[model samples]
Target: MQNSSPPKMNATEQAYHGIRNDILTGRLKEGERLTETRLSDDLGLSRTPIREAIGRLILEGFIERQSGYTTRVAHFPEDEAEQVYEIRRLVECYSVQRAARLATEEDIAALRRIHAAMQADTPPRDQAAYQRLTEANEEFHRTIVAAARSPRLTALMTTALDVSMVVRTYSMFSEKDLRRSLNHHAELIDAIEARAPDWAASVMSAHLLAGAARVAARLKTAGSDDGQD
Candidate 1:
């Protein structure tokens, strides 16, 4: 009998995903310095694969070049984060509207499953739990974008949604924020299932804006505290 299992990741894939996971799980953290030697040693791989992984991550906005042959995990400033969310709002709102009009039963079912997984992970107890929740959340949004059936928009979403800084923002959600977010997802599912484009768009706009507001408020508070210190 043939084995039924996923293929093992190659060295480069291992390095890439290992580093990315560390960043997303908050082990590496924003602005933390990184080096090829350190990563290669840590991953038990040669410099070649680690270097390639670092290059890909840098292009993907997970890592940033620093002064003279150094790099650090990318940090999104408040304005940059606001801009990213604004772009997401514009893109995702339109996508969800189209999805409402065009989504198939399979698409809706997939969304429901993702949403259920998200609900199950709610009030993420630890950093690892939060990481899983964040992944489910990402998949939920991506599934909606795919349901729009626009290849061009999906490609754009791939880039915008891949930002590590944005992924990390899920860890910022408070209990109230988490509940409100789940409610938004439920409303969105209803709107899509009802085939009401306007309703879906309205709910999505509210959802994205509410999240942006929460992040903005938190950033402002952090800046104030830093100033006081």
Candidate 2:
């Protein structure tokens, strides 16, 4: 049989994904300097690949350059986040509307499986468990996004979610809010199963806004303290 394994990532791909993952997961803090020399050493690649990766990151908004000079991880500005949320609201609502019409039994089952795995307790304050929680949360939403089956929409929303800072905000959700979010997930499944686009879109819209508000509040507080958000 011919080999079926996936192709190995090139050095530039490796460096790009490593740096991007750190930015998304908050391992690379906002405004932290991205020195090509350090990244080349850490990723065990040459400066050429690291430079390429940084360039990609700049184009994708994972990092930015000031006056096309110093490179650093991008901060999640409140205004920018709100603008992204508005775009997400439109994209995701349309997605759920489409998913409600299009999701197969297999798709519904897959979504349920992810939803069931989500933590019911207050998300752990620890780093590792929290990382898993973030992954699960992304999986839950991404499954639904995939169900919509629009490559263009998927790519657009993925960029927004990468910068949304949802994980940072979700970890700080009040117990009540966390429970409410989970309950909304369950109800969303019900709407999808019933193939009710209006119902599913409604739930998703409210769910997003609730989380956005919480994150905005956190950003406000952070601004008062150290401007981390």
Tens-place lDDT digits, model 1, residues 1-229: 9989878889999899889888866688678999889998888999999999999999878899988979999986899878888899999999999999999999999989988988887888875577678888888899999999999999999877865756766666788998899999999999999999999999999998998999899889867986897
| Pairs that collide, model 1 | none
Candidate 2, residues 55-171: lDDT per residue as tens digits?
Answer: 888876778898656898877788877776677788889899989999989999998887776653235456545556667777878888899888987998777676335554566
Candidate 2 wrongly placed segments (more than 4 Å): 1-29, 32-62, 67-69, 120-122, 163-175, 226-229
Candidate 1: misplaced stretches above 4 Å?
1-29, 36-56
Tell me the whole-model lDDT of each prediction, alpha carbons only.
0.87, 0.80
TM-score of 1: 0.80
TM-score of each: 0.80, 0.70
Model 2 RMSD vs true structure: 5.3
